[model samples]
Target: MKNVIVRGYDIPAKTMVIANIWAIMRDPGFWKDPEVFWPERFEDSDLQYKGHDFHYIPFLSGRRICPGMNLALPDGMKPEDVASSEAIGLLFHLKTPLQLKATPVF
Candidate 1:
C-alpha cells in the first residue's frame, strides 16, 4: 500500500510512504518457510490483525486500518471482516475428498 500526502504549507508536493505488504509477508524471520502457506504459524501466538505486532498486518495499520470496522460495533470482528470469507465458505462446501500428491525424488 503506497500513500502520498502533502505536508507543509511551503512545500505542496506529496510525501510518499510505501507500505511493503509483500515484503512483510515474505519475511523469513517472522514466517518460517515464508513461501509456503501455513496457518499453524499463528497457532500459539498473540499476533493480531490490528497491525500493532508488525510481524503481520493483513488488514494494514494506522488510520487506514479497514473502514468496515467503523460500520460495525467494535467487538473484535475486523479480522473476519477483511478475510476471504467467500473463498473459505466455498472450500467448506467441497464434498469430495481432497488430496495433495507429491513424490520425494531425493
Candidate 2:
C-alpha cells in the first residue's frame, strides 16, 4: 500500500478507509426513497451484492466477503414476508427477534 490521491484528496498509506455502507445504501443520490424499505427497487435493476456495484454491498465486497454470502430464503417465505425493523443502537440490527422453525429432512 502506498500514498495515493483519491477524489482529489491525498490518502496516506495505511490510512484506514471504512466504507459507510449504511449511509451509502441509504443515500438518496443513489437510491429513491432510500429510507423506505422497497426491495422492488432492485427487482429490475442490475445491482448486486457481490460488491461489483458500490450501491449495494449487503455481505460486503471483495476477497474479505463472507464465505456464506450465497444464501436463500426458506421454502415457504417470500422476501416481503420478512419484517424490517431497525433497532436503536450504534450498530444496525432488526428490532424484532427472528424466529425460525426448522424441519429435519431425510
Candidate 3:
C-alpha cells in the first residue's frame, strides 16, 4: 500500500515499498480528508477489487482473494443459510438513515 511515484512505466532498483494498507488508505495525497468516509474518492477511479489497479485492494486479489469467493455450497442452501442459522446471524442489515451526529470527539 506504499505510494511509489514512478516517473516512467518502470520499477526503480532502490524503491521503498511499504506494506501498511491502513496507513495508505488514509494518505491525504491519494485521498482528500482521508479520515472522513467518502465513497466519492472512488467515483471516477479505475480501480477494481480484481487487481485491475494496484492502488486499491478492498478485497485482497490473486489466488488468495477470499475463501468465500471459492466456497461451494448446495444449490438450495446458500452461504447465507449457514450464516444466519449459526450464532452470527445475518452479517449485515439495511436501514434508512434517520439522523447522524457529528460530535468530532477526536
Between candidates 2 and 3, name the one with more favorable lDDT: 2
Between candidates 1 and 3, the one scoring higher on lDDT is 1
Work out the TM-score per prediction. Answer: 0.38, 0.51, 0.35
* Tens digits of lDDT, candidate 1, 1-106: 3343446334334655566798887887877798886655665878665546865454456876656433432354444344333324534544333233344658
Best by lDDT: 2
Clashing residue pairs found in predicted model 1: none
| 42 Cα displacement, candidate 1 (Å) | 0.5
- Candidate 2 to truth, TM: 0.51
Indicate the worst ten consecutive residues by lDDT in candidate 2: 51-60
Name the candidate, 1 or 3, with the larger TM-score value.
1
Give the Cα lDDT of each candidate. Answer: 0.56, 0.70, 0.54
Model 3 spans with C-alpha error above 4 angstroms: 1-18, 58-106
lDDT of 1 at 69: 34
Q: Which stretches of candidate 2 lie over 4 Å from their true place?
A: 58-106
